[model samples]
Target: MKKLISLALALFMVLSMIPASAEAAYTQAPMLDGMDLPPVAERMPVEPMVEDADYLQIGTYGGELRRAADGGNWYNGKPIEEGLFRFTTEGVAEPNVAKDFDVNEDATVYTIYLREGMKWSDGVPFTAEDCVWFYNAVCLNKIDSKGIRNCHKDANGNPAVVEKVDDYTFTVTFGTPKYDFIEALTVDLKWHFAPKHIFEEMVQCIIDGKNDEALALGKAICGMEFADVGALGKETLYYFWNYPGIPTLNPYVLSTEEGKNNVKGQYYEYVRNPYYWKVDKAGQQLPYIDKIVGVTVSNVDQKLMLLLDGTTDFETVGMESIPTILESQTQINIYEWAGADWGATQIHFNLNVEDEHLKELFNNADFRQAMSICVDREELAGLLTDGWLGGGQAAPAPGQLGYSEAWATKWTEYDVAKAKALFEGCGLVMGADGFYDFADGTDLVLNIVSVADSGAADTYKVLEPYYRAAGIKCTFKDSDRSNIDNDLLANAVQVMLAPVTNIGDISIVLKPNSMVPGYATNVAWYGTMDETTATGDLLKLIELKKQLDVTASTEERTAIALQMLKLHEANQWTLAYVEAAPAYHAVNARIQNFLENGVWSDIYRDMGIAHCQCWFIAE
Candidate 1:
């Protein structure tokens, strides 16, 4: 009865995201740096993803932007791919490779239009045939599927009906109204079309009744050994991004061969695509800059060191990096995007551990809630961010649509008495040494596994004392990133501190990883495709999320989202600390159109909703 009431209220407070209205009509975009195009109006597309208002300058072409990557592959995703749609500063989904789209009244039928003169970076014409090939031949293939995309499927579990209308147009029909499809288009991994020319051999094999050969062709195209093409199919086909022969739609094409690339190499390069479609107001091709240079540093520390030393042009700087960067003598502009990336530092209590006693205690709601209240969030924030952020927020940050104060404030108190009561109920007793002990006369020890990094090591230092004050012995085990990843998926680590991802979006609850057993401990293994692994509350969440995908009512969707948050709050599976904080990044002051207001994201591969095409450096 109590659960029902809270869910009812949460449904009532659902956020109605007001989308930005389109401009009345297309207007000629003005150049930012007051530079003119090279008179190539005849070569430009009929329509381009225009940002006339955002351009701060219209500068000349021919300067190389020097940036640092932690590893070799970072530049491929950052500079090489462009999604069908990109989310603008106003949180609206605007067309990118696609020109425009229309949906039927029932929302089942969507018609998409392509920019007529647009071509792949290799000078091949982009057409409706390419999109249809991507949908039917690539995405819906039998041998190895990319798995069914949740957005493209309907309530009845039917795949979208795709049809090619003409050279520059195509239609996708869902079984039901799919509102989330638009936003899904903005994500990088949601590639709607692949260049059919490069994979023609695989397509031909599929048509000629040679599927094994087709699969082999797919593997070979991705430059992999035949042994690596296990049943997973094309999931490993990331080789297409930098495959020297494959055509791309990005502003710059990778100039280096994939085999020769080295992570520890001093530098790599990307040259401009002559067939790039977007143009400036003055009729010059977009991507005013001619080249993108990625300089590889040995480790994470070197990235910061180079940035501070004024050697690198751009890199993300965290809050902990602020005091140090500010103290540096380099004249840099620090763009402090506050609450741009709103994830919390959280500790997941692994409920699937092999130890029966620990697992049983962790599964108890009271035990979980008590641990939630045991932390001093104010102190954690002070130690981590020097007091810039921390007022007790939970999984969904304040800016997200589903954020609830009730959920955020749940069990967030430095209550010693309450923690003692809750811990006592779980069969833990106060020890002679003023710490908690089990019935077996052993001190209660919490082993927190973390990636061995300077930042993570610093966090454990603060959390250890907080647990100690509550009569529980605290210990931290430093594990490398590869080990932590394996431990989380294999359900090996009993407890670990990880930053909570998928914040600021109510829609994210629909994803299988976050709310399921795969990523975090203490949650039932219910969200995976294998339904037998989960039951009860985990199953309930899965059903609610499916309903969210199909439900038409805004209030109803909000209620469902709120119910999930409430369930997570009641479960208290994670101890979340410090949310809605400022995230900082430093760009070379000479770079233009890098940071904007009201838009920030943490994921680096997509380049933080990157706009490298429009950025230019003055001479």
Candidate 2:
């Protein structure tokens, strides 16, 4: 008996010496140590999102990633912003910030379940209230001055109601069936939940009509005063990077104080969020890199040099830079991402032009078809992209969803005789100067406006000779980008040449302005019709848009989108020079885990959907 007791005592002693077995915890970056923050497990949600995709490599944490931001910090914003859901390479909306979600039978209600313990960068718990607050304060109240968007409403035009179910769950109920609402939430960044705790008091002040108090609170948060509460709220909420104190759900938070002032030649830095709520398969907290450093390069030359020298980690380059990248191999690795742009350079003739004759000509299907077939797209493609990209119509590519061969190939054939005949059919008379004149004997001169110093200008230059050969007189009007933008907004642009981007199958559904009309971005048809005049092709498009609004299934939505494109094809509303081209991005070889051939889509959030959290710098 004494020997048995001794044996048990010995076993206890051994177990005690071995130490109590604690729960396995995730390993956070060493930089987070001694920060007086919670443990990795505590900081994470109840069930932290595990990024264990086959392509993901367990990366070591340390070192800073250097990237160029020629435009502004906003260029870097998309990669970091987290919405309720994220777009997949296939343009499907998958779970992201929201752990899971459910839709009712008719799809009028969406119940979103967020991660239970997820916290904002500031360590405040993120809840359904944040989303509800945004709906009530911003959407319902129109604090941003942009009234409730059409998508946010139902068929009856009643605003969607957001109701909080619990701290981590909420439901959005539309007055009518909104089947594509989940995709809508994924595509639109404005719908993402805001940090209500940060903005509550100021919002209350604004709601109470205490303008002075609201301005003071906003000034304290943003470090700048605004002319009004609306401007103040928008800059503070939408442009959160400019005010870093406002918490973020992003992997990294801006560490630089410059904020909005981090302009050309200035540098900006982003530090990894210690409270980031994701982990790799190996149980290491992400993002793998310690920091992201944004450096400004004034020109493409400087950018190219930086890329070759490995001073910058990554930068998107055009096909024109392919030769330079190949010649100077250095430490740069080049790969192509499937481009989403449908029209490399598309022409939009203002259908609402004040000149009656011009408007009639622009609206005439034969006249538009004549202009389209006049330009030799094959030669234009060669001149523009050195034959890298093939000539295509003003429609989605074959590989893209919603692509219709019948629609895409329509009016795309290069036939000068056919074009001239069609022009004559439209009442255009051949004049003494080898140019066509209007039916009323007025000189048929079109102002082909484009943003100055842009690729659109180059396209216009190439198209000028074609237009001249086709007996169409047009003057290239290169205007400032801001001026062109203002004109587009005011529907004052007569004939504009611009890149028609983000026209992917899913993108078109979200931003249908390019084809459906009635939007400032729809320079082709903005102000073209009123309630009385909305008929024929426009009426068909509007009805199709209604179907798209309530379409839940991806297949049905795609079908509806194709129908809309068919209308445009039949009408020849827009003209195209080149089709979608593959996008090339150069990355420093040291940048590990960067997606080599990810889909390059603005709708898919570019690198944001590439799992940037898994990227690391090789030692």
Candidate 3:
């Protein structure tokens, strides 16, 4: 399993000499011209990441990029996330923060090389110690260690041993060979390094049992003080944006404080980092845009209005909004990115419902089959998304790892007679109210729920008649998204309809929450598992997920994944509709160098790898 990525080899071979004057080497944003800052040559890494690739255009520096992120959580932290490595548009992993890395034989040990002379946004030198501190001190702290991040653990559930080899080098050794370690690093492990200078003393204070000192340090730096040192470290470092004083390596740093930003208006702002490490082809510091301005939007209508009125330069829109956006004749460039989704909307029944009658019915395979066949998938899709989604069955999309045609079409056909027969087989009888009643003659009414603002109610409204024709009564209920999650965890939801998007190629293994039980995504079987009570298929899925985690061989991992999918096909744990619709995001026509035809995936971290640093707003 020995492998090496030598992306920085060519970079080191032909190093460009820095000009005598800072102005000659690289240009800075006009906003920073008079600020007390180091010269560009001194601030940047000795071998800075050069953006001379043909795919990106050299952009001019200026203007604020107005983006709409609900509640100022910009792109779910994508814009500010700079990981150890990043995936290219071609889906290949490449070095980013770490210049290069090497995996030893059997893939148990990884040696990472950091770029020299790299500095945090606050001008403190970033070194291997920072990486080690993040892994050992913060992540594995004795006070409140939450254990290693799921992705960072190896197949055997063993955490890596992070050690600093030198100022610019570190090694991570796992107990077993982790073949897909690179993907794990690239996908989920953002913030591979932290600013040790800022947080180390506070952590030390906490570790030394000086609670008061730790609190004072945290409050003095970031205006954050938590009784628990672990929680304090986690919040300040993991969610660095909320704390203005936390240094970062990202292109932009949060410029607004908590009280400074309007609470009612819900505004947040970011300014370009003067010490950012990347440079463009023309020797200009990257992040062509000088600042990023974001606002919290109450609804999609507000988002669409911002797009139309030019208040926001970029925003992600749903496929259902395409018709409305097209009719508006707005000049915003709607980028139709290829979606990596198994289904747009899916249904899950609570297998562990507290009510015995509902639980027994939901667990009946025949009842579920009847439920699936009764819905006219195509009609529902047309009514809901204007036919933009093309309807679906309960299966993986064409390019998904374990996709099969038979599975794709299984139990998807609309056959009222077959459904009625299946219902009869389940001992359900037609009632006076034109709906089915349980075996004991009790009337059945499924309370369907979904995320409140997700437009799922409209989908459920269209689906009501289809279910009614099948002799099933259902009422669509709406609640806050968080409340819906709480309901799922509490086993309060009888049926749930929601969007399922983690269908990207690598997601089969990396993100198996929807397919595997115990997680919130598969809340139907959330608390129904134990040694004796676990179903054979459920046990098989658990085993397969474990195998997927540690199996380093891609071929072996795919084989295991297919086995799990086969079990899902036989069991029908969830039903699907409208799979693999194109994902849309609107950008101001003036913004340049944004990637086109990108694959929208959670594994790819959405827009994190889209080279936003190269995007410029044209005059």
TM-score of each candidate structure, all chains considered together: 0.78, 0.87, 0.86
Pairs of colliding residues, candidate 3: 155-550
- Measured by TM-score, how close is model 2 to the native structure? 0.87
lDDT of 3 by residue, 1-619 (tens): 4364445544432443333454466777777788888777788887777766567787888998886656533253675678888776666667788887888778888988998998999899999999998888877763323346655677666678999999999998888777777776775565677788888898888878888888889888876566666667655766666557778898988765674332224776777889998888778888889887777787778888888788888888877676777787877788888766666667778767788888778878898899889988888888887777677866777777677888888888889899999999988989888899997889899988877766787778788888899899988888875476567667688877773233334456656656676432456434344324456677778778777776767688878988888888897877876666676888878999888878877667788757788898886
Off by more than 4 A, model 1: 1-44, 72-80, 141-146, 200-227, 230-245, 257-264, 340-343, 349-363, 402-406, 427-458, 461-496, 499-540, 553-560, 602-606
Deviation (Å) of 502 in candidate 1 = 5.2
lDDT-better candidate, 1 vs 3: 3
* Model 3 alpha-carbon drift over 4 Å, by segment: 6-24, 74-76, 141-147, 201-221, 224-235, 257-265, 323-330, 350-363, 427-448, 468-495, 499-507, 518-534, 549-552
Candidate 2 segments exceeding 4 Å error = 1-24, 204-216, 225-233, 258-265, 353-356, 402-406, 416-420, 428-445, 448-454, 468-486, 500-511, 518-533, 551-559
- Best-fitting candidate, scored by TM-score: 2
**Clash-forming residue pairs, model 1:** 11-559, 32-57, 32-58, 33-57, 33-58, 34-58, 35-58, 351-522, 436-471
The candidate 2 region of ten consecutive residues with least summed lDDT is: 14-23
- lDDT (tens digit, per residue) of candidate 1 on 204-232: 67656776886677655544434433332
| Candidates arranged by TM-score, highest first | 2, 3, 1
Per-model CA lDDT versus the true structure: 0.62, 0.74, 0.74
- Model 2 C-alpha lDDT per residue in residues 149-217, reported as the tens digit of each score: 655778666888889999999988898898767666665543467889888899889888999999999
TM-score of 3: 0.86
